[model samples]
Target: MRKIIFLLFLIPILGISQIELKGVLTTGNSGTDVWEYIDPNNGKIYAVVGGNGMSMVDVTDPANPVEVSHLTSVPGFDVKVWQNYVYCVTGGGGTAQIVDISDPANPVIAGSWPSSHNIHIDSNGYLYASSPGTTIYDLNPNPTSPTYLTDIGTEGHDVTIRGNRMIDAHGFAGTYIYDITDPSSPQFLTIITDPDITYHHQGDFSTDGNYLYICDELGNHPQADITVWDITDYGNPTKVDETADPSATPHNLYVIGDYAFTSYYTAGFRVFDISDPSTLVLADEYDTSSATGEGFAGAFGVYPSPTTGNIYINDGSGLYIFGFDGLLG
Candidate 1:
């Protein structure tokens, strides 16, 4: 069996300040899958270990992150945090584990839901989970005990919730929209399926909810590109722009203000300026050639800390925190 390794090297530019690497958190286990989330209220970082279960770390001190707690309830493959709670979905498990991290150092398992792979939460306190199907849970009644509202089966790969609308990246099923004003009974609004496109992996919406950035994971195909869609009119979505990079297959994306951060498999992390939704321009890119793996090695996720002015990238190796100075500006 071959081993995977991440070689860290810094390149300095005369006029441009390089993004500083704050810390690297590794489990010392080979082939460990890690996903991280930062609490908006506090600059604390939390990560879930895919291969060896989940681990929570207090990254308030970026230089030295302390491992606060670890839960082996299920091998967490994906994680999403909203408010003081962290929701994680396991790889082969049929249930999703919900943890109450109000006390950051001491996290307790609150509840569990069946059949979940990916999840997203809205400002209104609704938990949207995705597996082969999509399910919605109400988190306002009780933070610890979630109320199962409705299960909207739609072959969802990933879900993003904004206001009353929930966008579903339905793998080969394309992107579907649902109106969940009434949490218990969601209405299927529309389905946007373009045959010219390949697999729609993961995406995020603009803060104003005017546009959406969709990433297609099927790079071998010509249709693989980061597509920008105008969703001002939820009933009718229009493709604004589509851009592709020759070196990578975009798996997931993060949109903050006018900048969009993309995690590209094999090609590394690429940054694009989306000041104009219809026309996106490449601003900067960092190649992690050393982070390559056999299957899904490259870059899996990117989390930009709004408070610390730092960006964290997760490859197969571990969670790496980089200070984005020149990259964002």
Candidate 2:
């Protein structure tokens, strides 16, 4: 009888141990807009300031996330990190701020450039800024002093480079692909546009590099959907499949091993199994509904903890971290 009781206790304990939740940091009464969050090479936590400026947090212990320090720049939208530096893009100011975060606790502004909202860093240490268009900067020899290369903003919003191609999520314009083999002169290759789409918000290439998951901020009807495209042929992209739930208004998406985590506006965080890209299916969903409205209360950004299996979600109120158990299985 005692053995049976011991087994029961062990089972529950093991199950709970399989999953764990950690609350990293919380932003207080500042009413500041926390837009983009990135985990730098030094294993520190950094986030872009939207409403006010930029802030840094130490999430070494995700459970007790504490704000280390912050630098006030004109309000910015997104942040990208390469090596020991943090690159932030201002929304309306039209410039990118370079901060040396070699020390996570105290970040110092290294330099600035005429850029906007989103910034991308390539493997070669080149920084690409997206705003009025796509601008490339050479941040190789010295990060603090980046030499402006050229701006390729014929059309696009957020720009990212994979292998030899530069992809742009051109808002209502659609997705554009360019060849950046010659960094100095980027040759426009092709433009992939979906007639039924409105806004192409954010996306990333799959681990396999064969497909691209594009998030349409504007839902099909009044809400957006997750549109998957086959970029096997970078020059001529093809649409594979699209999934639209009644509560689909995906703002940003991140692709993990076999799952795609979507940060939807009012729907919160929705998870889908993309093991089969053509037939992507919904696996599970967590709703962070707001008391303000149906789709307003949930999550703004979802960051899957690198060290821990838990997932951190940022909403209008604060940050919520949850362990992956039934959700992952």
Candidate 3:
């Protein structure tokens, strides 16, 4: 009887330890960053991949992704979607362009901007371009043709929108927060920095908007690559927790509910349990690369679809689709 009880206990523990994102499908052969677009008219889903150029892939079936369109003119290093349009920035600091995906089968360049490294669009349709700094644009009346708004002087690597606040990951300088409640007039909040910070690469806010997670691109090998900050006091942020892996370098991290998913360069896709902001635990991981080390050679981006619970990872080789049923709770 005691042996039976012990076996049952060990079974549950082993199940939890083995829990991870199961690979659902794999398609394509090259991509940099990946973002999803859900058509409001037809309710079909699509994946915008960034790499050699912009590639529009129909992901409605999730398991079988088909390349619907490709725009080779616009260099796609980073990508984002807003409504019916898709925004992409060229690799190695080229330029930003808006692509009309109203018809996913025939995507066309709608507009273009000056040299930008990354781009983002908020819920209110404000476009934030990281052209060495943060350049704001209004996409209200015309998303295809954005109107220049203003510039927030900071060496921005990436910008994220949380409610009415705009957070800029300013590489070596750290993170900057601004009140974008007024799209044109942004009010400076405060800068969050720590002595250990090497490069503030990308960031995302908690679902409840209480904590901020920053991924340091250069911090590697047993260093605090992913830092969690308490942003309840917007003006004065506090470092609450941090985590890292010795084998991989941190790139981008996205917080969805209680879990934090990251695109670890060589380590592939990593998931952390952030139920407690003071202490983060690595819950699961999926290696998307055969090579592993503290270098940039693997996964470049990880996007979790809130609508379908499908995890999308773009690596040096191609795009991977995974599904995690843990989000059902």
Candidate 4:
């Protein structure tokens, strides 16, 4: 009884010592993508959730996110915002759900393209969809519809684009980098693989684009390390740093400046300082669960809104919005 009383007292103190939770907003169900877009017309940011069809959130008020419109029955898997329109795929259902967000409050289907697991867009309004292998499309000619451009015979779980450089995390097989300077014909640059990097779940690049930070997932247990690599040289990726949580599996992550906001399935949200490539310092953490021990039952995705540094996360239960106090020591 004495130990129990002491532990209960320590819990709140530990929580208070960690990061600040500004506010959390959730969806009707679990959502994987928190797609943010700035209204070219008004400049107010809206978060489009990809889960059950889609949910439009007014994140202009980041603290109190309100779901103004949603399509709960469609069950969307991934989404990418382009030219004020949303291109999404119905995960297992296979079809693109093109939504027009010009109204913000009420989104209507603009059109549909090839459905995919993951969708990546460039500043040029071109798109790369991970339909297992990659299929490139041109949304420039028609914002409502896409004209198929090309397809790359490669498969991946997720893909990220920076400039003309693109990479696909193929899971267990590692990642492949590509030169997409010409969307009509994307050149495969190289494949990165490491014994510890099997099941390359998700990855993001450093602000300068010289480094690639990749994280393994729930598939390859024990290989939970969020491994870092030096990608200055295209074909050769050199391993640099690695970090992990013994109790939880790391999921999606987004970096803003030198800070990394990562989600640990059972452990909740974590903030890391990546200013120094040699060492990763844990800046703050917020555990989403009070249940004993751990095993994949908490936050799975996190999005750091570009307009406002406020962070948003979605667990299996609901969506949460948080405020990040920059590198608070």
- State which candidate has the highest lDDT: 3
Candidate 3 minimal-lDDT segment of 10 residues: 17-26
* lDDT, candidate 4, 305-325, per-residue tens: 666655767666667767765
Q: Rank the candidates by lDDT, best first.
A: 3, 4, 1, 2
Q: For model 2, what is the C-alpha lDDT against the true structure?
A: 0.65
- List, residue by residue over 1-329, the lDDT tens digit for candidate 1: 12322212223423434446787666522123344556667656655434355667666676776667777775466766666677767744477777777766677888776746777777788887776677788889886667888787657788877777777888888887777788788788777777767777778777677887787777454564778888888778898888875656777787777677777767766777777766678867776546443236667767675655667666666666666664455
- Ranking 3 against 4 by lDDT, winner: 3
TM-score of each model, in listed order? 0.80, 0.79, 0.90, 0.85
Say what the RMSD of model 3 is. Answer: 3.0
The candidate scoring highest on TM-score is 3
Stretches of candidate 4 above 4 Å error?
1-19, 27-29, 219-221, 289-296, 325-329
Question: lDDT tens string, model 3, 113-152?
Answer: 6758888888888888874788898888788778899997
Could you tell me the TM-score of candidate 1?
Answer: 0.80
Ranked by TM-score, the better of candidates 1 and 4 is 4
Which should have the higher TM-score, number 3 or number 4? 3
Worst 10 residues of 4 by lDDT: 288-297
Residue pairs in collision within model 2? 24-65, 95-115, 133-153, 218-224, 219-223, 219-224, 266-295, 288-298, 290-297
